[model samples]
Target: MGTHRPRGETARRSRTLSGQIARVLPLLPLAHLDREFDYLIPPEFDEIAKPGVRVRVRFAGRLVDGFLLERVESSDHPGKLGKLDRVVSGEQVLTPEIAELARSVAARYAGTRADVLRLAIPPRHARVEAEERAAPVPIPEVQRDDGAWQRYQHGPAFVAALADGKAPRAVWQALPGEDWTLRLAELAATVVARGQTAVLVVPDARDLQRLAGACTQRVGAVVALAADLGPAVRYRRWLAALRGDAKVVVGTRSSVFAPVSNLGLTAIWDDGDDNHAEQRAPYPHAREVALLRAHESGAACVVAGYARTAEAQALVASGWAHDLVAPRATVRECAPKISAPGDSEQALDRDPNARMARLPHVGFVAARRVLAAGDPVLVQVPRAGYVPGLACASCRTQARCRRCNGPMAVAASQAMVCRWCGVTDPAYRCSACGGQRMRATAVGARRTAEELGRAFPGIQVVFSGGAEVLDAVKPGPKLVVSTVGAEPVALGGYGAALLVDGWTLLGRPDLRAAEEALRRWMAAAALVRPDGEVIVVADPGVPAVQALIRWDPVWHAELQLAERAEVRFPPAVRVAALDGSEEGIVSLLGLAQLPADTEQLGPVPLPASSPDDHEAVRLLLRVPRSAGSALARSLAAAQAARSARKIDAPVRVRIDPIDIG
Candidate 1:
């Protein structure tokens, strides 16, 4: 179009469109098209076609959206470059830092950069982009207070390091009765006080609200990033941070990618939460993302929680991060008085059948006393809903649906249904016992609440779990029944907490079962008053339960790391999951050249993936941590090759799959 350039342009020689050229990354899911495409910056868009801005360009035969990666003086393309169709926005939504982060994450997860950016940057809102952006707010210096951090041995030192602009990595194990939200807010404020920015990522919107409230009084110019915020509002808030108008960002997983400049710190609370694991392609964990961002930005990294995960322990073991924890004496003083079946006094007074008791003898006594004392009693159940479990009343056998052979469950309406196939079995008879009666084999929150209400007739019974989780419960002589991770924080803390049905959590088939069970137990226990009691209804001898009794999660975490390392599992090694039709997986494997010491496991059937997935299987590749990058490249290259060949049945490749059950 430029002056009707000579036909054929000297046999496809470049149609020179000045020296200005822009390299753009098209937002397409195809792995084969992962790299930037050279595009000519026409005179019309020369002023607004800067890097990081959104633009539309012609690719193949259709128009596609892309982000301007950078400008180059010349292009290596031998053919004529496609001029950008137009600039979508003059505003740079994708900050260079975030762009770099997305690239690093893509490489780490063996995913296309486009996919990571899709998660990092929300969809653009034309109206929001046109709105006047907020001016940068000056960060207020917070008075350095050792209010909460002083409880930990190196906590105060960590804060001081941040104030001095020294980057330190810490795995913080919060003590019982500790105000973790307030502590996280103070940590962000410490970095902000130094005129830098900080990011605090939690697991859910509930935590986001609490954290946001805590930061308002301490961390100035704070903005929240969450999925629940409407598209326009979320985009406006994200734009605020990108414009350098916010000093602190606090929200859920997405906040880990906040584009605040002058980065000082990145922290994640309750990093082990399953909610923090992204379900999309690449499947990045928020904690890992925080660690990466902190490393790239030279910012302080804090992984704070009541319990330590195996990944966090690996950091401490490798000397990559220090353990910030309280001394034994201080921890004990703040921890609730714990009672287990193994304790001598409790054993002497315990009922003979305490081993399988839903409410242990000591637990019932503690709950009664706490309720009588006018303080709330918190009962933590492992599962939610009413009658989530069903058993044969006659033979004491688990009830299963006749059609799908899946476990049966009864709803609150007193109707039985198959948990897996969704078939109603109102007139069901036990296959083994031929009995039409079903009993609750495992008690859920609703059933527990109903039982507790009957046990304590005069007390109020509050339910906090499922679709209606309460953030906080007022202190009073009430009984609170909740599922793990859904326990409401009671003002001044509950008088006592009873962690019931612990066997369900400990018996899960997932790799993180033991660690997760302990984490959930400790999180619930942490909500009790210092002088109050915590009674967990599980065998005290189990390592996880023992860790809770001693209030030393590091012990369990270290043990887990050692155990997993011996088996070449995660945190010590890297594992990737490849699943699809046997044909696709096998073809992909044959195409990829795996690194040495790559152990192949499985070819296991994935019948549960879908009813028609009976023939689909999953194969796992385990490799040494040092070879993770090479392994990712090999897998990604194989995927790209398959895509290039136009293979219809695609194999799903995920590095560090959420659960290897």
Candidate 2:
């Protein structure tokens, strides 16, 4: 039989041992051009022209930045190849696994690999890179037997599975009063004991700080990665993870891609937190990325949160992961007593003033009692400003600016400011009824504090939100009014919590409004002492309120998952949203090939801010979970093909957008 070489092999081999280069061109992030280009490596620069090294390449008659992905002995290209300009850096900042991950993430979100790489790796800082390397500090080993894990039904098995390198997947339902940071640290230590690395990704810096402290308490040291740190410190921490010097990495969203060598476990805290979602292209959620990394690297996965997301519940439903939850008695013991006055019609009838009052008389009385007992009272508000919106007092009509017709709002010093156009009107007349008087339509944290301060003259009123958010507060008999997601932790848990304007939070147009509201409520409530009380101003009969009253987030999440499945929404299925000029979006959708069972809705016109602005449309495409990968691949291919033809009119394609509205 005649000897045959592998496909794409050159029949006439080069005697010079010519090297092929996979150049990651730093050009416009066009879908069609989102791939590596083949280049010939010159003989002199052959040693430096390797994969994972940044290089300057001559493309389109200009020197552009690029990353060399791979080197080969031959090329299949019929045309003459351009030689690499020069090697930019010897440091392999783009590791092989990360490069592969970037590509995979790009394809998954129908985005260009370059865009994903931009977020994956920060800009190269020569000074930071040249700094002397310090030996990674060793962390103390945690006890093999943990008393906390024993309290949960499947926590011990989950810990054991990870420690034994079984690569188990779990959705940890965090108990209200439990120390999740310590629990997560214990899990990381167990994985480290197996001689494997672990990654813990939280939602923000506050959580990162707490988790880092937990790691220090359990282990000797932890590599914390956060944007708030100086560039030098942040880069050092990142390098530690890349060089495998850091066995345990704790950070926010970006740390999900930390190049920990031999990753054994990846855990995300509060997966439902909007902060976990990457705002850049590809927009990969931290939970999804961790799950993907775990799957690819054979690492165990843990998605833990007080209130789980529907997406996580979907994973448990498919048997892809197990639910690790505490017993009912344990939850009850840890959770505070919860009540909803709106749930009972008799309670509403007995005190009609409490129904519309921001701080109902009953709630005010409860707060006063809690303050009298020398304990802090936490009041959760929905907005942050003094008065976010205003309306005409006489006709109760929304006040708008004459210049832009934008809603008028209260700025500093009771000034009437147009929120949209930034026009200030100290003396303005209402366009609707020619009324000069203006009143607030929505109450904010500052306004709530102002009123509460007057109501309780002797007690102190502390504000905890907006530009000045606090991480921790002293335990005192004070009223701390904070907006959602900005509630500060008390030294000891707050004695009482009042959740005000629950309707404003739950009545949003978004699909996850109730889910998000429940999460916010639970997060605030979790800060209350076990013996304390949480009074919700919403109706008790509502599912979200009931969930809070019963302290059963798992039930709420499961119910949400079921509802989404019935309605063919996300998590139950995969969804992608396309947005752009009406014609551009329509054309892209038409050109793209989708799965056979794909269902599509819209080309629906989206509301424009001004009449002069161009009208944009949105399209939502759905496919079964099994077909998600196929659909993503098809969309990426279509986009790449379109980009290749230079047909770009600026259409945005996002997969599983959190704000579908």
Candidate 3:
């Protein structure tokens, strides 16, 4: 063989080659590769690289980051490639299932493998060292409450199917008015009793805080993992779960991958929230990630909210999961009296008496009635600050920074600062007309709080929004003004709730605008007393508003789905493509090669930080539901080709986007 070996072949075999050596790596999927390079793998690291362990490599002309994605027996160059620089850690960072899930998600979202990996796993520094943590103490099991057990019995068999360490996946739709939070807590307890860990994902941190308190009262030693946990503590808690120390995990979107040991149940509260979608790279949604994790680990999956999403509804219609419902009579009884301003002829009148705060005829009247009997009222606002931004009343032109195009806000000293981009312009001038006169269009929580304080003279007015002012606000004889996601009221609690300024929420340009608005309304409404009244300050005729009026979320979702189906939007059809600069986007679009039924919507204006940053443009492609998987594959192929080309332009792709503004 040596004598017969061709000279060219032998010479070629001796040359160094650059490319990813391992078949798999533990690192996130969208890692950038500045240049191709060779890496030597030591014999000790060989077994670890079988596919998931962390490895060190010399990349990009420097010792940069790289995941050992896979292993190969020989190099394509036939020449000698350098051995891996070193193995950073022996721990298997990527499991085969996790890797597959990441790939699927990456393909679906038109994202790079590295991007999906980044979202699935936390940062290396964020991982807790198992050795540093003490073993979890074994506590005496408490007797199950009879009432809770009975409620658990009412859930479908699929709910208990998760106890068997199989795919415990179920899509549950709770009829409006039922106390889902209390039911979810009971489900958490049931899962915990089976000697396994559980993860509960809510729409925001406030919900997490509320659920955390409930879980702590129900089960001992519950750990809350939210971004609010300053870096150090968050890392510590994250490590505890990674090391199998903490069992119960409750948090917002990012907590979907919480590393609870022997994972049993993964429940998502209000999965329809746009907050549940990661706005960064890969753009993987928390709902999809949870479903994938459940499928992979045989963990129980529960998707519950006041209103069901089209995707969830589709799952139920397809018979993939069971729909859990409260008796219709229970929903009818528990649902409070909901009325909309639009239903009344005087809704359009600007009369102060028409205002819920002034007339004491709508929510205010209900609040007074409740308080007369000694109860609290909850008010939900959409914005946080006194006034987030200012605009010209004549032209409706917002004051923006000349350099950044970011909305300018006057924060003390009359100084203008861009809320985004952080461009501070001491002397900001309106570009539209060089006008300085600006008026506040929407009143935020701070201003609303101040207004309520003045209006309700003797009654205390408390504010709860971006700031943690919950402690300053007591429950009785007061108006608790708070932002939507920042609502601080407790469960089974508020005597009455007023949903103000429906226009602000419905006016959003996103596709899920109505869905999100309804979720916020329900979350607040659920907090009110069963006999309480929910007065909404908007035309009740609007679908979103009317849904609240009748407490008929199912109907609203159905109508929304019908509209989506007609337009080929998500849950009806699938859309995917890379969004970037003219050339790169064109290249990506060309590579996508859409099918006959599939359509291309735009290479149009993407949400940009500024009008001046024109280097980036968005391209969108829509695929029929039947061709979605194929389209994803084609997009993935395009990505691989682009990566091989080492293109410089940044491209971002998101599948089934929740926000299409």
Candidate 4:
């Protein structure tokens, strides 16, 4: 319990008010401090102190900022209430819809309302809001059917439903190299044609730029919102949406919460991308947020991705959303020809020399043929460095730094570098075999580019990775060596592609290792023309590789969902991760009063790059999906109890954390 102010009685009697104000203090989300407290509205400040307005109040004997939720005629308290200190902003930044959504998100994630509100509402920019707000502008018509959307079975119907004011939910599996921006623009235009607004949320700024272009082409122009914008600019954009000035908003993750009036549709591009997950407390995912918004606003929902996640599949399976995918023949026609390790037996037999090299001789032949036809070739590598990981030449023991036990790799000038602790060793020796010689365990893009440069002789080698990324490459006889997301888009699509180091990507310890690898491969392969060939140096027997070769992400997602269900992993079951001091976690669990059926795992130390004075461990709590809300409530209750008792020792809670480990 908080301490009562000595002058509280006097302060209450100093003001005569018609109503009490429900205000929530803007403090760090300490559980017990989460609720709203009643304050007597001073007669002079009565007009300004209203719901959704920012106010200052005295809390725990200190002045703090808060948002006024509502004003009521009277309070249920037997004791008199303290008067509101002052009004901060009369402009209602926190709209009723957004406030409710924030509350729901907080409850769902076992997070404090204040923390969720912090993320939901941006900093108050008075100047920006005071400026003349823009109004929704009329949009031009866009071409609907032009080979862009004809591939999907439900593509036309999805657009029609939005235009007809029918709230349709769909899980769209976009074809490789398909124009998602164009597709999203068409949907927005359909909604606009019906005199309604739409909110489109993508994973990153690049996606935002592309979607913005599409929206501009189809629906005139749209308001853009993202974290990278200056505070004033971001707030102005948000205000436009809140004021119904913008009918359509295209942006990154935060755009899901954009207050577009009469929202007819909410779309998320690449829901599987990790960028969609908020890093703040509550950690709401964009896809789930959009779904919630769609349901609340009676708007249509669209979740599209190149590679589907199990969660999205669950939505389709549960009939909550229809699966919008291209027909078999269309997919086969659009997808590049894929050849896995076993599938390339004929090519290897034709050229024995190709099998002897890492790049593969068949890949060389394909490169030559594509270059002759004046098309660039994209080579995808798993890493970007001279040498990413190394091992002892004699015994194959993984090279590690002696000081920090971090995995060691060779940097420029043959100097050994630690991937974890940044330690360096010029004269490193093997611990197991006492051998000084080292071997490359995994080759990186830079090294791969070097090898290819020599093999291909005079042809230009364009390296794209790290900081230097190319937006779009011109059609030429060039070899573009890039790592995963950094792969440059060729002007006319790559003539051929080489997906190397598949084993390195799939062998990561993370749960989504194989799934993510397939996604990366698919993204790169999608850049290749339909007539182009994609040579993957991975065993065809692997499910991920087979899925890639067959161009069936849906099948792979289904298989993954089944596997997760069997193991009781997320999407099958709801999970929460609590990371903190061992003592703090144990205390929290004891007081949490979680569901009886909830399963708890670990107090295991977190994997750290360097030794710490105080060890940090994490606790995982899982319950059946049906009882998810119950679990969250119980945890929240426990947190509140801890805060009330002043027992806070710093515990971090994350719901549906991306990295489960």
lDDT for each residue of candidate 3 in 363-440, tens digit (9 for 90 to 100): 556767776866777788887543424665444455655653335566556767654334567776677787777666
TM-score, structure 3 vs. true: 0.79
* Candidate 1 lDDT for residue 537: 80
Q: How close is candidate 4 to the true structure, as a TM-score?
A: 0.87
Residues 438-521, candidate 4: write the lDDT tens digits: 876567789889999998899999999887877788888999999888888788789999998776666553457668888889
- For candidate 2, the per-residue lDDT at 233 reads 80
Off by over 4 Å in 3: 1-40, 43-51, 68-78, 125-131, 139-168, 173-182, 216-222, 228-232, 260-262, 342-361, 384-441, 468-473, 490-492, 614-616
Report the lDDT tens digits of candidate 2 across residue range 263-357.
Answer: 88999999888898898877888888888888888889999988878998888888999999889999999899898774567877878656555
Which runs in model 2 stand beyond 4 Å of their true positions? Answer: 1-28, 345-349, 352-356, 385-441, 607-612
The digit string of per-residue lDDT tens for model 1 on 209-323 reads 8888899889669899999899999999998889888888998887899888989999999989999999888889999899999998899999989999999999999999999
Question: How high a TM-score does candidate 1 get?
Answer: 0.89
lDDT of each: 0.83, 0.79, 0.66, 0.79
True-structure Cα RMSD, model 2: 7.5
lDDT of 4: 0.79
Per-residue lDDT, model 1, residue 20, is: 89
- The weakest ten consecutive residues by lDDT in model 2 span 1-10
- Judge candidate 4 at residue 63 and give its lDDT: 85
- Deviation (Å) of 82 in candidate 1: 1.3
